[model samples]
Target: MGKVRGELRSHCPINFGIEIFGDRWTLLVLRDLLLQGKRRFGDFQASEEGISSNILAERLDRLTHYGLVTAERVAGDRRQIRYEPTEAGRALLPVLVEMAYWGARHDPRTAAPKSFALAYEADRAGLLRSVEAGTNPSEG
Candidate 1:
């Protein structure tokens, strides 16, 4: 069955987000946009997980439709498109940070920095601020 853009399984707050980005690939796409400084289709395709082109297209479309991402054509290159995280998407920083922190702490093979948890624990707000500052906003 085909799903509508922005469609949700329920009105529950938690369910709302889960419905939009419950899939691992979708979340990874968001991670790329929000945390990894990725902007092009090719960049996402080259992700560590090696997502296929088809799924990447679908997830990008879904994120754009859900207002978590914005796709815009760059100047001087009408054929090139760049994806950026929206304010709504940037709002997920804390969530991503927590998830990263958990993984770093629990996953023995985690590539996250050894001091990540400590630095995050010492100044969570500062960490969030830095990430927010670094996030590239959509161009006008």
Candidate 2:
């Protein structure tokens, strides 16, 4: 792998992409947005890895700025703002799914949940359906 040089903004497309989500927390925040339907600070705080409030706030802001996420106020709850994935963000689903499947397959200690393992075993179409069902509100 080539080393990143002085100014990141001038790097190639790959470097630019990594610059946005190169950190551990950024992808975790994206995972929460996709799998858990977490749209608020409190919800993210309650996730398994227990991200810090300050970090969560910063990630949300960055995600919003990158156009991967959009914030909207909950109807009838002016104080509650929800963060949701945009079309670009939703396009990352396949990448996340592939990563999960690869991890479950290669890592002996992963202990992936039964449903996830089952989905990994199925055909791509079936696996995508399962992922969609899990992500959609009515099924959740």
Estimate TM-scores for all models: 0.89, 0.80
Could you say which candidate leads in lDDT?
A: 1
Query: Lowest-scoring 10 consecutive residues by lDDT in candidate 2?
Result: 1-10
Please report, in order, the local distance difference test score of every candidate based on alpha carbons: 0.82, 0.75
Off by over 4 Å in 2: 1-8, 133-140
Residue 79's lDDT within candidate 2 is 90
The sequence of per-residue lDDT tens digits that candidate 2 reaches over residues 1-140 is: 12223357756978776877778888888888886678887888898888888888877887787788998889999898898899888777777778777887789888566567665665666676666656432222
Positional deviation of residue 124's Cα in model 1 after best superposition, in angstroms: 1.2
Q: Candidate 1 lDDT, tens digit per residue, 3-60?
A: 3365567899999988888889998998888788999999999998999888888888
- Cα lDDT over the full model 1: 0.82
Candidate 2 displacement at residue 104 in angstroms: 1.4
In angstroms, give how far residue 4 of model 2 lies from its true place.
19
Q: Backbone clashes per model, in order? A: 0, 0
